[model samples]
Target: MTKTYEESSQTGDFLEALRLAVERARTEHSPTDGMIDWRVAAIRGQRGGIAGLNLITVVIEVKQV
Candidate 1:
């Protein structure tokens, strides 16, 4: 599973943050069955501005076979 977020900053810091989090989770064996089959989790940003940002958080629950 994966979660994503976006911000209006000129630098790609948020992307990097999400990538690092996923990588850490994968390495730490937090994902079900030790593998990532799809994006089962997500936190998306719907709005952004110079002062702040608004986001819609999505949570995906997975079941292992």
Candidate 2:
């Protein structure tokens, strides 16, 4: 199975939310040496069930370099 960094944003727009997510991820997870790069294998937003009407899930992943 492919493994990726997953995060959630509270924005209706995917692109806008992604920008913020990436920045946060980089700062939090990026190495101090700066030898690693995160490649987005997939970024998706899914709708939740009836309970979470406006719940948005953001899934981010690093693909094979």
On lDDT, the leading prediction is 2
RMSD of each: 6.3, 4.2
Relative to the true structure, how large is the alpha-carbon lDDT of every model? 0.45, 0.55
lDDT of 1 by residue, 1-65 (tens): 33432223233345554555445545544555587433435555455688555544333333333
Worst 10 residues of 2 by lDDT: 56-65
> Candidate 1 regions off by >4 Å?
1-12, 30-34, 37-65
User: What TM-score would every model get versus the actual structure?
Assistant: 0.32, 0.45
Q: Estimate, for each residue in 1-65, the C-alpha lDDT of model 2 and write its tens digit.
A: 33355555665566665666566666666656643355555555556666554434455554333
Q: Give lDDT: candidate 1, residue 33.
A: 58
User: What is the alpha-carbon lDDT for the whole of candidate 1?
Assistant: 0.45
lDDT for residue 1 in candidate 2, whole number 0-100:
32
Clashing pairs for model 1 are none
Candidate 2 has an lDDT of 0.55
